[model samples]
Target: MLAAKRMFSLAVADTDLFLEMPSSTQALYFHLGLRADDDGFVSSPKKIAKICGCGEDDLKILASKHFILPFESGVVVITHWLLNNNRIKSDRYKQTLYIAEKSMLEVENGVYMFTGSRMYPERNQNGDITEPQIRLDKSREEKNRVNNNGRKTSRFTPPTVEEVQEYCSERGNAVDAQSFVDFYISKDWYIGKNKMKDWKAAVRTWEKNQRQKNKKSKDDEGLEGWLNA
Candidate 1:
């Protein structure tokens, strides 16, 4: 049986990471947490959002901000669910029915992270529907380094355009592979003043910056429209 009462952590709800989101999105998150099962999985977020006077954009914001992990079956799991409620009684705690989705996730620092490759739909900049692509889990890659002599070495390997393309494709983001390779090649693969340790992380950062830029552009367009009106 599911627990009747739920808990929230001030560490999560008080931080800028949670506070920076729009009020509606924050409200949606709380509602989701309240309605979630003991395993922190919500099988019907859309219905909950609708009932709470929230919209699809609120859910999208939560997903984009990494506050929730969405599955293809329309289920979502709170990313910091374990962090919020870590001491539930074993008898009342029930496992999530989304075992497949749960298997894809691993906990790190009390947060759920996707560690498996799964295909998900994402729209391009042109607002066109594209083929679903696998999500990349960079943490699953080998971290140990070795040289030709099989000795451990701390060397950075610059990724090729094809490699970047594969990663970007898997991430289902609009990060141009050729441009990324070209920019990093010009910089000698150094991020600012330091040599890059992980190219996959850099690619993810670029994707994040691109998303912020796009959101800012949209906000500017809205401002301009309002001013003209």
Candidate 2:
């Protein structure tokens, strides 16, 4: 999709041509009988005459004299030839901007930039802008969110004896040296805060259980501890 476009080139400047044209002819060019785009062009001569307060005959007379480019066919070749010449100088003759699809396959000044799919704006060869870039970027972000389902959100999942055994076997009994750092930071332990915090938490539970043991409420000491006792 083309969001915007701008054609830039210096207007034809030659005092000889200027002198050849009458003031009315020059005024017609100033008002302009046509508007150009990257792929096409347009002009409403009727509206133009009405807006400029120019008589319909005056517009025809001026258009004939100045060779004002119209939306009609063959203008592209005419424009190309004129731009190649050194005599004309409008700033719009040399370059144009076309905001199009991000997915638009483009060759600009002989370089490719945008690639992949388009939506919203209709395709037109005459545009310099593309909207496909936005579409693909949004699509990727949506895909990532969808792919992350079933992923855990818990800060820790208690380490298992099996995991500890696997790690020791992988190390062949030689300490990895960074094992402690990994255990502390990685999901391998799900460990957080300090060892002191774990100890404090354990002590609180142990003391509560001891009170239950003293109370002796029918095996409340815990099955393993009571069975041992």
Distance from true location, Cα of 6 in model 2, Å: 6.5
What's the TM for model 2? 0.25
Worst 10 residues of 1 by lDDT: 127-136
How well is each residue in 6-32 modelled by candidate 2, as lDDT tens digits?
332233323333335566555544444
lDDT per residue for candidate 1 within 82-132, as digits (tens), equals 878644787767887889988878776567766643334344565432332
**TM-scores of all predicted structures:** 0.54, 0.25
In terms of lDDT, model 2 sits at 0.35
What lDDT does candidate 1 reach at residue 167?
Answer: 91
> How high a TM-score does candidate 1 get?
0.54
Question: Which pairs of residues clash in candidate 1, taking residues 3 or more apart in a chain or in different chains?
Answer: none
Candidate with maximal TM-score? 1
